[model samples]
Target: IATRGLVDLPIDVLIRIAVRLPRVEAVARLACTCRDLHSPAFFEAAMRERTARRGGEVPLPSGRRRRETMVQALCRGERRDRFQRQNKIAAGDYHSVFVSEEGRLMTCGTHSFRDNPQPILGHSELDDEDLQVIGGDSVLVVPRPVAGLADVRVRTVATGYAHTLAVSEAGAVYSFGLGESGGLGHGNEADQHTPRVIESLRGVRAVAASGGLNHSLVLSAAGEVYSFGAGDRGQIGHDPESLFVPSRDRQEVTERLQLTPRVIDSLQGVRVVAVAAGAYHSLLLSEAQHVYSLGGGGATRRSSSRGRTSRFTGPQWTPQINEALRKVNVVAVSGGLGYSLVLSEQRHVYAFGNGSHGELGNGRDHSSTLYEFTSDGLQQINARIRAQQRALATTDAFGRHGYEVFRHSMTLADEAVPRLIESLGGVRVVGISAGGSMQTGGTGHSLVLSDEGEVYSFGCNGYGELGRNFDNESEELPTSVPHVVETLRGTRVVEIAAGGASSLAATATGAAYGWGRSECTGLREQVGERKSATPLRFADLELAHG
Candidate 1:
């Protein structure tokens, strides 16, 4: 028998050897050793073996297209194979989190007080070096396992303006990060740098949880609701009396803050199946298919029968039934800063509240010049102007107010109550997400995923959050995310998420894509471009795991 060197072996035999390599890196090194082993057929066979290891099929190249390598590196040099094991993902104002199959938690993006806190120029007077070392500001461009949470098995995760919440497989809740306004639900306003279980919920098994701008909601397995944090706007679902006792002389009611979880008495016997939180509002969907809304009521100034300004309107302090949606069999609900969306079993969609930026998808022409100013209309307009002034004074002090001014100038004909979004009548919507901070007057946006794996977006596109290639102009009606739909033509979208100014989508094949504002989270650089006008493949995402 003649002994032959490895490089002299036939391409087919060398490919078989390469496929047996334990790691993709190992196969790459083997290919580098011999020109014959570096052939496309060899790499393709190796890729097929890796796909089989990940429990997925390696899609054959279509037409003249070749099979591109599915594996890529994350920004921080972490392999995409590591991210393929994640089961869930969530995004906050400036950060994102992922949970692995083994329950390991990984986080990335800017988790700094400077990025998430309300813009207060003098909140910290530390020097640059001190701010970097002691201000609790940090950035992780690459996914890194959350420190001290190695042993805990996280089942799901949720993010808010400046904090994060994770539920364990054992039904225990863990909270961390900015704790201002009692958002941490720790019974005190103290920031938690590490994962800490909420002692009060030790005996209660939480099935679902949501985090808002400054509040949190937890749903128990028995359909009970628990809330804590800023209740000034009645987002906590407390009784109006408990929030504030109206006085004859005080024009402004002192907003109440809750530091610990409290049961929503109004929904004691109601079986709430799902809960969603906005900047200052909460939405609940019950087992009977009824929907309820709370908070954002105190912001509307209405004249009472006695001619005094009735600050409390509709359902602000209590979990009142949404009368407009009483006739619809609501199966899903999503809440934004100033609006809410509901999906019926029939796939019909309904929206309510502010639609100045077309967040409602009602197709109302906001640019019409027709003017009609009645006494009541004038009062409403004046109130809105006052509110806008206050918002500008605090945060948008030097920002543009053109959109606000134009929106206020138009007739106030947008939906204030639940109305059917006829534009999406034929499509079956299975998922929905809303972005923008209602409390901050940011032009909000909305996204919906249909049953056919298609995505539609409306509302603000100033930063290209809509992903329609149209800049600045808001979409008053739903439009398709063409790039995403075309790129993943044959794949079914499995999950979707919307952040303050960005959107994410994941396919059944485990592929991930993202678009929109990339500054705060450093996503622009990760996508290898500075502009985020269209969806880009998360090149580092590996969908297969062995």
Candidate 2:
């Protein structure tokens, strides 16, 4: 029997195959190998998925060729995988979660080391509730299938600060973890040891979901955003006044809690296709390729000269489109501890908010090596530096902004405006991540996946999160680290996830590698002598995902 090329297959059949391949790179490769998939039928399939998820009537300009616009939306889920049909992996503050090829949810990491653990493993508290093995004084857990969701076919999984949210193929949303302040969306503030469907969202099928430090966001297939949990800083996208409840600690004071799934009225007509929950803020993306931010975006006021004054962008209880990100055509957005990020359609990464520990990835952080000013004086100098950057907005070929050399004086500066990372010049990046620094001094690192399947890591490496190992143990890590992670230098990473002080990358062949603090990474001692700075594969992860 002769072998027919995959490209010779029907357009519908090719699309079905693409949808099942689980990675966008595979689909792109298929199209590359066979030019037949470039026909209008294939483009239409891509167009249909984009339009359906974004709720946009116009995915293309008036006169562009199908091939031209087709490349724009290719590679991975643009809206933070808001419309992704399936997800293979997820990384949290202290756990690694995966959705197997068979649609089973697999998890590994420390779950509640302090005796009374939050049921983050997705195992029912009733059966999996035994105290974890006590290795000395630390509690450790082994990777296993989520017993509570054993029968349900989970499509995508998201790991939050201390919580987990799983979306089913049938569009059901199940949550487990620390449920304080109503983060669980169970109509009450109760921790779910096992996965439980949010009854209020039963009628509307959720396409994706995200969990913040103390909040939860669920996205509908129709491009609507539903929010719950602590609305103290407006992360939930609801009226700030209505979020106040009587404080349990004091009767005279109030607290924050939104117990049920409430559609964000502010984003009603806007059509939000994705959501990203930071430590205290939230980032949302619209179908129109615009990014929106809310909650406590730090009040780092910077005065600009060319009408680019920066103030508190939002605490907008109501979600509003970011004017700075208006024309960039943002495809993906991520939030972390005191910082946020956006990936442009051109593969350029823009960062703003806080660069305290170099999360901005522009190769600088608020350090004392170059500056002798006090904290207050440092803020003033930073304001001037940002003001100067805003004066000249012309971008070079590599998205590099032209600015005065005064950056030397104020070496330690935080980004008030969405600054384009000049260091990542000439690389067409495909994916990006910003990990939160909930533990350690600061692990708010950033990782960018390039078109060539290599990863560029920067920001904090307090626990070897950068994965760029050296010959000696004490090689002296840089203050603002930004370079291609050594272990992943030659490897082709299909997906990546950053956590508190660890980093994870998935290869095309289904192998996963992680590096960072020992407690978080699933890597075992046998993976090259347990070097924290080197990327190593965990046997448990291999067995689970494989």
User: Which of the numbered candidates is closest to the native, going by highest lDDT?
Assistant: 2
Determine the C-alpha RMSD for candidate 2 after optimal superposition of all C-alphas: 8.6
The candidate 1 region of ten consecutive residues with least summed lDDT is 390-399
lDDT of 1 by residue, 293-347 (tens): 7776312212222332222243367877776666675677777655677777667
- Flag clash pairs in model 2: none
lDDT of 2 at 202: 91
What is the overall TM-score of model 2 with all chains considered together?
0.76
In the order shown, the candidates' Cα RMSDs to the true structure are: 15.6, 8.6
* Candidate 2 lDDT by residue in tens digits, 24-126: 5566676677567766678557545544444334433321223555445433233334333244666777677777667888776665665656566666543
Best by TM-score: 2
In model 1, state the lDDT of residue 38. 63
Residue 539 shift from truth in candidate 1, angstroms: 4.8
